[model samples]
Target: MDANDLRDLGWTSEGPDYRGSRFHVRYVAHIATHRQGGVANLVTDECRDTRYAERMLQEWARDALKHSGLSQAELARRLTAHLHRAIDRAAVNKMTLGKRAIAGDEMIAIEEITGFPAPLENADGLIKVPMLDSLVSAGNLSPREPVKPEDVDRYVAASGLPPGDWIALSVEGDSMDLVSPPGSVIFINRADTRLVEGGFYVVAIEGDHGTTYKRYRASPEHFAPYSTNRDHGPVIIDDAFRVVGRVYRTMLDIGPHASRRGK
Candidate 1:
């Protein structure tokens, strides 16, 4: 998760709760730097358009618990472990009802722990999602910000996509060409950040490297990428790395394939 993720979800950095807090400032600055240059598209308390029916994060959590059978405290504890930070039940409770915007990491942490799919797009049919100008490098080490270019815009529409905050990112490397070919546009759901073994994800490496699109397999200690290009290999899972979101579909100029054909 990065600044674009926060911005896409309506998180604001200029709220009163964030003011005068160095802790918030530092982390906000850290994530903001994930994008090398483009300005944020839109940073409002409410989403720019009314087509979306936001199933609030807290509401999503309550619904998720019906299946996971975990209490808020238990979920918070699991999240604390996942993020290696102290996050209590109160923090979780306050998030949906408070002024402080939820950070991208926690957004993902909640998704991973709940095992619940984020709410699908609440529209009737034929939805148009913005095509981000940025390309998510399909290779790992050569990180390029998947930050959307707001200067210019394009939109694409497709039917039958399993929805959840869907956005498109152009692909730039051959590492995952069997699925996401270079020059293709990958439609990913920012709300679906869970790391299912052998699942496709758009991931990021914090400092120098940017973002990559690949299939993820988890061992006890590392994130192994199943790449068509053998040169791109496994990455040790650490604070420096994060699964940005799952790649749900890919639109290659040659054709669009809904199912995974290779590892």
Candidate 2:
């Protein structure tokens, strides 16, 4: 795929400070474990001196596998069972880069196996420096101070998403405590709106400050947004209401610092 052609397929550049830096998104095939080699390969950058690559790989695997319907326990079981057949980081890394270098008919065979074309032309990922202070614009979080999107990025990165693909936000209340705790750092995908019911999401609604987070409850009459803390109650649906996006992932105990990338 041509780099310029990627935009047609929803690919774009991303970086830690989308507001301040210039970053490019590189697209690739989403891989899963294979019996031939059980590890899903996703990146090709030479490991070199970057010990952090392992952590990045682990996190990406979690997100990719989870999205593929493999539970954490199930993933562990599979890895343990396929340890011998499992592809280690070195081999997987090579595979990712090789996949990125292929061309023509070869790309088709690779795509069939990975569900993504080889020499992947353009980026399929997106990144933006989310406004941290808006972490809890919801009524519940109204009392807290804002955090930085870059700091949230690091926290979310440790949670297993590419830094360019994650955004941090503060928890407004306990409405999502079954999963998200108050003040926890939330890593959200602005494009993921089809969140599973009963799952958590970050919503925005008309508020004194602007938009805020709410537990998403979809129904015929309205997109019922709720709060975990009973004191907050549920905000019913209306014609003007909309779901900004779903909370596919999140993190906690993020260190107090801004993301330092590019410079």
lDDT of model 2, residue 7: 47
Mark the 10 consecutive residues where model 2 has the least summed lDDT.
254-263
After superposing candidate 1, which stretches have Cα over 4 Å from the reference?
A: 1-124, 135-152, 255-263
lDDT for each residue of candidate 1 in 1-263, tens digit (9 for 90 to 100)? 44455658776665334433344555655445544332333433236443123335445656776667887788889977765567888877665444234454465556557777544343224455666656443223232344344521344555577757766777766777777667777787777888898888887866555676767776665555555788877666665776667888887654233122222
Model 2's alpha-carbon lDDT is 0.41
Provide the TM-score for each candidate, comma-separated.
Answer: 0.43, 0.37
Question: Which candidate should be chosen as best, given TM-score against the real structure?
Answer: 1
Computed on alpha carbons, the lDDT of every model, listed in order, comes to 0.60, 0.41
Q: What lDDT tens digits, residue by residue, belong to model 2 across residues 1-263? A: 44444445554544122332332342223212221233334233334323344344334443444354644454434433332133334433343333322122222322332333222222122232343445443222322224333333222122235433335566655655656566566666555656465656565555442355655555533233343556655566543444455666655443333221111
Q: Which residue pairs clash in candidate 1?
A: 143-210
